[model samples]
Target: MSRKTGTLLCLIAGSMMLIIGCSKSSEDRLTTPIPPSDCDTVNMTYSSDVQPILEANCYSCHGNGNVNGGVTLDSYTGVKLVADNGLLIGVITHAPGYPPMPDGGGKLSDCDINKIKDWINRGASNN
Candidate 1:
């Protein structure tokens, strides 16, 4: 082929490959499972399940010296207060009329929410 024709063919081939490579849907491109979280919602406990989630997601704003919205989650009694008043579920689940919690941190994972709900359903025990 002539030099110009050959260059044109190569550019066309490269463009086709680029288009095909970029056309894949995100899921199709991702071979590994997204996050692969194991959600165990059974037999939830305060020390093991609930408290840790609160510590990670809530304590920054609602624990220790910082008590936003007059809520403190540093103690079981404080946590229980919200749990009893339905504020725990309402805020975490981002239900209307209840402010979504963790504030700027966004909503908790579905697994974490389920664990908290299960704990509440089981009487929001101290255990």
Candidate 2:
């Protein structure tokens, strides 16, 4: 092979490998379940803990005025519907087969997510 042709082939191969390496891994794509160090997960409540996180992160698209994707999270009942059906947890956790919540927004902090998980584990109470 000509020197120039060999150089071109090497460049192409290197570019492909770089692209492949830059791709997100399965674990990186999923919201990693992280335990909160300072968050008090003992008594998580919908009103106190979960609502603020949702209001800040999710209400833009999923609130009463919007209801995008047929999901409204403005009220406790609305939140409860998805919570009961597992969509809330699934999306928030970025679990496979479920669309991530807050869409293009960053994933919820470990403290917030852990609080939500704790609340859900405790029956997703209205309180």
Candidate 3:
């Protein structure tokens, strides 16, 4: 092809590619990105945050009137006992000489642990 025609074709091809790259389809734009974690540990409350974690992980053995190891967590009073003694944090954090909690299960999630710590640092109230 003539030099001018060849140059025109190259420009057209580049322009088409630019348009295609810029004008992505709705489906392409609608990418299902893995959203960041919604692990909100702000304003952690015993009733809302701490109690739920205990009920799910500790209640089976330490709650509902079971009181295994004399460690009760089903009620605010029982929980306060451990919280005051630092046993709560020690066991949950798997500290040396302190048994890991949830019996043989893995450690609690970072978010759950953070929520508990926040509540305790806020005085571990009945709220």
Candidate 4:
């Protein structure tokens, strides 16, 4: 192809790609995500939502009968004690006068933190 013709074809292809990219649906273009159903924190439950998160995150030092700092998170009653005393929120959120939990690990994801917070706010029930 002639150089000018080749260049014109390239430009046309690029323009079409640009148009396609900008034409994405609003859902596709969302600045804030539609929260995933996988992380459903709504009306958070202790056994289903809260406990799993703790089992994955907190159980290392506080589960399987491994009690650290007098905190045991392997079961509902243990978790309730921490939740009632405000230690759950304080430590997870790294509030002043409370030790940062996970000890050596990074802070829990905001979603996990929110889930625990929601569970705590919802009376920290065993159910």
Candidate 5:
């Protein structure tokens, strides 16, 4: 074959190989069912169970009086206020009219969300 024809054939073969290699990988996709929340055993008033979850997930904006949606989850009373008003449960559960918590992205795990729900169901006490 002439030099120009040989180079053209090689370019076509390289482009085909590139296309096949770029196809999506089956293993990278998610295909499992997510479990529902388990809130029956969570205690809202206990600092051990509740504080860390709040500090890590909520404090960034809820702290220092920078409450985002007219609600605060900083102290016991603040958390209780939202809980008593049913806003906490509504947002965490992503009910139709309310947006999910942490507004930026990923939601709290089902377990954590359930714990908050359980706390609210139990009257959202400060104790």
Candidate 6:
């Protein structure tokens, strides 16, 4: 093969590999399983169970005045606003209405998401 032709072939192959590497679906990237919490059987309150999740993943923007979408998750009441607005649950569950939380972070484990749902279903109690 001529030098130019060989270089062209290598470039094509490299491009194909790049495309394939970047196209992995969300599930392909997730490795950790969300563990079941004691919050499941009983009420999952924001103060006890959900706050930590938000603190770890959401507090940066939502905690202070620079609230995204006018919503906050710093306090139980703040979290409840988004939860009642139906966006929190939707985002967490990857439902149709809103984009997922943490935008780029991997999806939360099923158990963790279920706890949020349970809290929402139970009226998003602060206690």
Q: By lDDT, who's the top model here?
A: 1
Question: Which 10 successive residues of model 4 have the least lDDT summed?
Answer: 24-33
* Stretches of candidate 2 exceeding 4 Å from the true structure: 1-37
lDDT of each: 0.92, 0.89, 0.90, 0.89, 0.72, 0.79
Clash tally for model 6: 0
Q: What is the lDDT of candidate 3?
A: 0.90
State the lDDT of candidate 4 residue by residue for 1-127, as single tens digits: 9999999999999999888878765547687666666766779999888998899998989998789998999988899998999999999999999999989899998889999998888899887
Q: Write model 1 residue lDDT over 29-85, tens digit each, in one string.
A: 686567645788989999899999999999999987789999999899999999999
Give the CA lDDT, 0 to 100, for residue 23 in model 4.
Answer: 75
Superposed on all Cα atoms, model 5 deviates from the true structure by an RMSD in Å of 8.7
1-127 per-residue lDDT for model 5 (tens digits): 9999999999999998877666444333444444554444556554656656777887887876778877677788787777777787787677888978777767887777767777667776666
Candidate ranking (TM-score, best to worst): 1, 3, 4, 2, 6, 5
Give the least accurate 10-residue stretch of model 6, judged by summed lDDT.
33-42
| Model 6 C-alpha lDDT per residue in residues 1-127, reported as the tens digit of each score | 9999999999999999888887665456675565545436357777777888888778887886658777788877888888898888888778876888777777887777877888889888877
Question: Which residue pairs collide, candidate 2?
Answer: none
TM-score of 1: 0.71
Name the lDDT value of residue 119 in candidate 5.
65
Error at 29, model 6, angstroms: 25
TM-score of 3: 0.71
User: Lowest-scoring 10 consecutive residues by lDDT in candidate 3?
Assistant: 27-36
